[model samples]
Target: MTTALVPPLAACAPVGVFDSGVGGLSVLLEIRCQLPAERLIYVADSGHAPYGDKPPAYVQARAEHILAQLRRAGCKAVVVACNTVTGLSIQALRERHPDWPIVAIEPAVKPAVALTRSGIVGVLATRNTVASPGLARLIAAHAAGVRVLPQACPGWVERVERGELDGPETEAAVAQQVRPLLAVGADVLVLGCTHYPFLRPVIERVAGPSVIVLDPAPAVARELARRLAQAGLAAPGPAPGDVAFWTSGDLAQTQRVIALLWGQAVQPQRLPDDPA
Candidate 1:
């Protein structure tokens, strides 16, 4: 009989996180808040900025590429912090890397259903994420009888990635996309994409005070913490862990956005398309 080998806890490396752009920083921020002693490696595949419109195969390929890079960088676990990518590629990733701890983001429909007073919840996400059968099943299982409105803000992610939060164009886009949901009496809105949290102010303004917007960052952070603890991979605390960032797009622009979002200077390393 063949014996299965076990990996030691010390061999489990830093947590790896990826997104199509800076939006994943929202999730990173949350993770840092919850697990201050755990090191993190974040990658922004900004060259492929909006994965929502891309084919499933393309998203999967990009995700696989990034995961390989993270593994090479000594990451023992990964988080698919983007909803579109998570929706399309997480299952395949888990299948391929069965030993690695993986956490993924999904729309907060269950929580929205639980919190809504009007029985109508709105989800603002990419077409790819909203259209996924996984999302449909989640709604069917956890939110039966509750009205779930999914709105795909096609250009919203692009605008947010460019650090354009509040302008005439952004305001107009937010208002246009949210009007129909509000019309249908949606009192709770889910910021379904990791990137969408950065646009919270605009979304709130468009949806009005009567509506509540929930960002899944806090929950994602909590889950990451739980997974690390369960796997005996949680880092001990005394000093804070280091955070390193990489991007496949313009390094300067990516650094600028990171600094803006993180409220500190960020010098992100630029990685090649095939960095091995």
Candidate 2:
């Protein structure tokens, strides 16, 4: 008989969240709103940011390393908050840690395909995610008879990382990729990358009122709640939970951007290149 990969932990154990960068904060906000009693520990692997352009092997390696870090931190479960990681490495992650209670996010293509009045859905994501086999299979499985356009927004993730959400440069970068999808009659847009949600206001303004934009963070949070409940891992009290953060990138810069995106000042701890 197979043994459980991780023995069940106390309900009060912190839930770990990680991403290539601060992009995961988008999902963290939703989880905080949904599970206020649960403590959270977030790690930003920003030294290797924009996993969208990396090879699957490289992305998988980084994911495994960070997950090990989270497990060592005594987390009850983990949330893979980066779509690139989710699209390319989720299957392997689960296989490696069966029964570890992992919750992963992916593009909301299924919902977008269902909701589109024009029968066309556009996805904005990183290059790797746009080309991932997982995403292709997702589209095939759920988007039958629908026109699904996957658009890779090259520099969009960097802009969000730098906290440039609404400047002229940011607007132009957004328009360059959005206008063509709109021209092709895509009435629904999916924010396939977590960082893209921080740029949602600009995208919505560019797409105008008729277009619908979807972000999967809320759905991810709900699924996390379900998984925790099923595992008997949900936090037990009503008090507001605390959060801690660590990053492999420049601490000052990450701190600044985290403050901007998270809507409060937070000092993120440093994640060592080689943790002991």
Candidate 3:
């Protein structure tokens, strides 16, 4: 159960953003940076964290639940900050809501292919995203003449949710995933999951400075700004905008971690459970 608040069209409505867990904070940061005047509401579905391993139907149902909440709140637009959700449901959702602008995050395979001096790139993501048909097509389209390795960092998302970013356990977790890619001569690593960006320092340490790490969050934010402008939904403000946070997990815990990850204090509201 994750939700967002949307104010009236004439009022200060916030853009909606949601992810399986706190991972989407990486995307939120970019959105805030690029669209400083626009308010944003972020949903962290931490009660059911790691949608990566869930079946397609289950994840879709959960996503639809969140989207429904946002739509009810009067969201002018939404950002699907979860790559797994993006790969699985973007088209279906677009068909369902033809008018609402939706922006999705995807693996930066094309750029990784272009940037790799070794002609080899690595993508670290959740299991579902790596196995997705959408990701497969992304590979088919852009990975030509380059080696693309997809590594599922099984516990990475949970680590970020728990705020375990750079200890020995975190180090071991990062090293375990990155070493294989490095050994395979992957010169550029595409952070296929939003959560992976927080582990960038450890990942850089493990992969060494020579390996370039790319996060797609900023691009998604820019795309959002473009789409908002196109739809004439961009918020009008010279004053700094406000942000709201909600989570399905423990309210206090969610607030603490969000404050940490968001680089400022945050007070998270409990996401009300959807009707059965």
Candidate 4:
């Protein structure tokens, strides 16, 4: 008796993608690159920014609300691009939408562990993501004998939201979180938060020439393509796809941030306020 999945929408119906903030653009870019035929509908839950520190219940509720909104918008599939929400609530999400082909993101720990030459892997994520039981299990299962270091990046998300990619303070923040891992022989640093990928230049600068900075967006994009194909949801290709954005934060601010992160100007649509 959970809500069953709705019938497949048109091939042209947009794919729904969401995150707590614009950080999801990293994932969106990959998806766009991989499946240029399918239009996208993205929502940034900026009003509740940084789900990383929120209680699980709060993040879960917001995730559910956004999913519901996307479904109502005739989306063919949905991508949960927020690691904090995915690690903590993916099962609940699947249970609620029994047949939806939802592609969720996770920290690139397995790949990082595999790519590490020094046997030490570092993961930088939000507080809640670092503490997530899912991440702990992932590390336990795949990181055998490897030293896995989890660092909670407190301000990276906010800085990205503010369009601060690299500056003195941003460089300092990246160095503060990364130097310890590099010093301890971590040759691979996984960008555990979607937001972190947007700050890759600073991360690379801080981690130096030897460390490999990894983001799971490409893998996520491939998986999404597979899911869409399996579900017969892939939009007809050859024709370029379009993007529509919605946010619960300041429209102008969100627009500016999305443009900076997304590499083009986008006119974001506003979501209707829910009285509930």
lDDT of 4 at 26: 95
Q: Model 4, clash count?
A: 0
- For model 3, residues 1-276, the per-residue Cα lDDT tens digits are 323223345236778999999999999999999999988889999988899999999889989899888877677789999999988988998888776778999999999999999999999999999999879999999998998999999999999999998999999999999999999899999999998899999999999989999999989999998987766678888887888898888888888888889988888987766543
Q: How many clashing pairs does model 3 include?
A: 0
TM-score of each: 0.94, 0.96, 0.95, 0.96
Supply the TM-score for candidate 4.
0.96
- Cα lDDT over the full model 2: 0.91
Task: Report residue 259 deviation for candidate 2 (angstroms).
Answer: 0.7
Give candidates' CA RMSD values in order.
2.5, 1.9, 3.2, 1.6
Better of 3 and 4 by TM-score: 4
Q: Candidate 3 — which residues are off by over 4 angstroms?
A: 1-12
Give each model's whole-structure lDDT.
0.86, 0.91, 0.89, 0.89
- lDDT string, candidate 2, 1-276, tens digits: 224434345688899999999899999999999999999999988888989999899999999998888877778889999999999999999999886889999999999988999999999999999999889989999999999999999999899889999988899999999999999999999999999999999999999999999999999999999988888788887998899999988889999999999999998998745443
- For 43-136, candidate 4 gives per-residue lDDT tens digits of 9988788999999999999998898889888888899999998889999998888777899999988888889899999999999999998899
Tens digit per residue, CA lDDT, model 1, 80-146: 9999887787788888888878899889999999999999999999999998876787789889889
Model 3 per-residue lDDT at 57: 91
